[model samples]
Target: MLRKIESKNMGSSNLGWLRSKFHFSFAEYYNPDNINFGVLRVINDDLIQSNTGFDTHPHRDMEIVSYVIDGELTHGDSMGNKNTITRGHVQYMSAGTGVYHSEHNLGEDTARLLQIWIYPDKKGYEPNYGDYRFNWKDRENKWLHMVSSKDGDAPIKINQDVNIYSLELRKGEEISFPVKEGRQAYLVQIEGNSLINEIELNERDGMEIVEEDILIKGKETSHILILEMSKED
Candidate 1:
């Protein structure tokens, strides 16, 4: 089955310098019905004003992924690693036992991105960090695996039975995948328009798919993120 989570239906919060939309219950946006779908626990669309961002915070027992859409984001963590994440770049932080990190907008314009959190298959693993640049040209009209179980393939590795795909499609482009039977998936449109099994989705729009044999089609020049997850029986 397919269900649409309209952009307007998302929970929002405006904290002056930071404006965020939560696709699932996050922070103060609590909803028992929308806690999560499969192992995908959090999908937060964040737009940070220039010269502002999130301060050092602690996280544990979760796999966090950040995708920068525009401008620059400077990341620094307790692991003694610091880096800049720009458009088309992804940063992953495996908060196994515990970790503290901060993100700052390093551009004059607003920095937009999606910060997603997933429940790991096992906890108390060693914390780690990784960042990589993904070429849009290589993924044109195709799905690029941006995150996976193993490292060196997608730059970022997480401890979960999940894979994340980033796709940039032309107006008439399309793609299909035979998902594992009995698993679930979540699609988040970061920009432009697209259609999943003919269901229209705009910017910041999301959907939870419980059906198998998924076919994703884009209706325009669009940027989309798909998280394929393994469901627990």
Candidate 2:
């Protein structure tokens, strides 16, 4: 099963300096029937104006990942770690018991990012934070393995049985992904346009796939994020 969600159909919030599209029920967007997909809880597509961003915030027991799409995103947390993540970079945080963090765009241009939240398999683990700067060329015309529970070539680690991939494709390029039994996936188009199994998706569009393999073809230069995981009961 493949369900395509148009970019404009998702709930959105515009707070002047900060604008966001929530893929699941978040903040003020509540849809009980659309709360989550498998263990994937939230996917927030955000654009932060220059020199402005989210102030100190609290989170607990959630596996958080942020992927910078454009400009730069500066991050600071109560754990005393601070870093600026640029395009093609990823930040991961395990808010086991609790943690406080702030995200800001100090650059001259607007910053775009996708903030994702996934449920942890078990609670009360140690809180931590980390990031990886991925080479753009690695994902060009193919899948770049970003995050995973396995320990081989994945750049980041999370506390869930999930695999995350990043793809940068030229026009007319195609890629195939297999969905094994009892597994599902969620995909987000970050830039340009593409077709997934013949279903058109524009920038910011999202799709949920279950129990079926997927073939993605780029209609134009496209950047995509994919999250695959075991189906939740």
Candidate 3:
């Protein structure tokens, strides 16, 4: 089954300095029926204006992943890690026991990022943080394996039964992804537009695929991210 969700239907907020679109029930946009997709809990599309960003915040028992789409995202955490990452870069933080972090856009242009939260396999893990500045050409017209479970071979490891793949497919390019039995996947159209199995999706749109293989054709130069995990059956 393929379920498409329009970008407009998702929860959104704009506080002048910060603009966000919440993929699942979060903060001031709670939806009891739309809480989550399996263990994948949240996907927040955020755009922070220049010279502003999120201040120190607390999180615990959640695996967080932030993917930068444009501009610069500066990150600071209690673990003594402070770094600024740009387009195509990713940051991972396992707020197992607890942690405090801040995300700021210190550049001139507005910074855009997708902040994702997934429930960890189990709680009370040692808080840790890591990130990867991926090469821009690596995902061109192909899938780039970014994050995976501890047993999987991705550069970034997290405490979950999930795998994340990214693609910067050129216009007219076609690709295929297989969702095996007993597993499901969530596709995030971060930029551009595309048609997945003939279902049209514009920028910021999302889809849920359950145990089905999908063929994607780029309607435009598309930036796509897919997270595959065990089915919630």
Candidate 4:
């Protein structure tokens, strides 16, 4: 099964400094039917104005992942981990029990990023923070293994049985992924345009896949993100 979600159809929130599009129920965009996809709870495509950002906030029992698309995102947490993640970099924070953190864009250009929240397998795990700087060339024309439960090629590890992959496909390039039974996937077009199994997807557009193989062809130079996880019973 496949369901395509247009970018404009997503829930939107426009604060003075922060503009966001919610892929699932988030903040004020509550929709019971659109709450989540398996263990994936939230995907907030955010644009933060220069010199402004989210102040220190508390989170618990959630696996938070941040993918910086443009500009720079500065992160600071109570754990004394502070870093600026640039494009092609990923940041992960497991708010097991509880944790406080802040995200800000101190650069001159507007910062664009995807803030994702996934439910942990169980609560009360230890809180942790880490990040990885990925080389852009590694994902060019092929999938780049980013995050996974089994820690081998993936640089970051989470507490759930999920795998995350990214790709930067040049025009006319194509890639395929097999879908095992009892598993599902969510895909998002980060930049440019592409066709997922012949369905067109523009920037910020997304689709949910279940029990079907994925074939992605780049109509133009495209950046894509895929999250595959176990299907909920």
Candidate 5:
């Protein structure tokens, strides 16, 4: 069955400098029924105005992934790592024990991004950081595996058994992937509209899918994030 989490129902925080939408109970937003889906804990879509951002914050026992949609985001962490994440970049920080980090919009225009958190499978491990840039042209027409536990071509590593894919589909394009025998997945439409398993989803809409094989067909030029997970069962 397909169930959608509409954009209007998502918790929102509107500051003069930033606008955010929370997919799960986060910070001051609390919804018992919307706490999380499987190991996926948080999905925050943030648009930060120029010269504004999130200050240094602490996190532990969580895997944080950031995907920038527009402009640039400057990141600095306790690990002595600092970098600017732009469009088509994936940044992963494993705050296993504890870590402090801050993100800011460094561009003249607003910066938009998706910040996702997944509960790590292990606990008390050392904190770590990683990042990679994928040329949009190479992966634009298909699904690109950006994060996973597998050791092959995946760029980001996580302390969990999960796979994350980003796709930029032109109108009329379609994609499909199989869920492991007992696994589940999440389909998040980042932009435009799409149909997954016959269910229509607009921008910022999401679904927790637990069925076997999954198919996605884009109704318009679209960008989507798919997280294939093992903890849903």
Candidate 6:
């Protein structure tokens, strides 16, 4: 089954320094019926103004992954890790026991990113942080697997039974993904326009796929992100 979620219908917040669209209950966007999708907790499409960002905040028992879409995002965490990443890059933080971190857009322009949160298989694991600077051409018209369990081959490992992939499809090109039995996935139309399994999706749109397969065609050069996990909520 496939369900398309238009961007216009999603919950949104507009602070002067940070504008965000919430895919799940977050901050002021609370909905008891829409708390999460499986273990996927949150996906916040955020735009941070220059020289401003989130101050140090604490988190625990959550696997956080931030995907940089444009401009630059600088990260500093309690683990003594500090780094800056730009478009097409990924930053990961596993807040097991607990951790504090800050995200800022210190660049000259606004920064766009997807802040994703997933529940771990079990709690009390060790906290960690990592980032990847991927090659743009790797995801050009192809799926670039980026995140997975520790046993999997993705560059970044998370404490969950999940797999994450990305693609930057050229205009008019086609691609496909399989959501195997007992598994589900969420697809984000991050940039540009796309038609997936006959559903038209514009920028910032999302789709939920369960125990099925999907074929995506680019109406324009589209940047896409997908997170696949077990079917159980």
Best by lDDT: 3
Query: Poorest 10 consecutive residues of model 2 by lDDT?
Result: 149-158
Overall local distance difference test of candidate 4:
0.94
Q: Which ten residues in a row have the lowest lDDT in candidate 6?
A: 224-233
**What lDDT tens digits, residue by residue, belong to model 2 across residues 1-233?**
89999989999999999999999999999999999999999999999999999999999999999999999999999999999999999999999999999999999999999999999989997899999999999999999999997453587989999999999999999999888889999999999999999999999999999989999999999999999999767
**Cα lDDT tens digits for candidate 4, 190-216:** 999999999999999999999899899
Candidate 3 residue-wise lDDT, 53-113, digit = tens: 9999999999999999999999999999999999999999999999999999999999999
Query: By TM-score, how accurate is candidate 1?
Result: 0.95
User: How well does each candidate superpose onto the true structure, as a TM-score?
Assistant: 0.95, 0.98, 0.99, 0.98, 0.95, 0.99
Better of 1 and 5 by lDDT: 5
* Candidate 2 TM-score, true structure as reference: 0.98
lDDT of each: 0.86, 0.94, 0.96, 0.94, 0.87, 0.96
Ranking by lDDT: 3, 6, 2, 4, 5, 1
Model 6 lDDT tens row, 161-189: 89999999999999999999999999999
> Which stretches of model 3 miss by more than 4 angstroms?
none
- lDDT comparison, 5 vs 6, better candidate: 6
Model 5 TM-score relative to the real fold = 0.95
**Lowest lDDT 10-residue stretch of candidate 4:** 146-155
lDDT of 2 at 83: 97
TM-score of 6: 0.99
lDDT of 5 by residue, 106-215 (tens): 79999999999999988997999888888898668788989997453577889888899998988888888776667888888999998888788999988877765778
Candidate 2 has an lDDT of 0.94
For candidate 5, the 10 contiguous residues with the lowest summed lDDT are 149-158
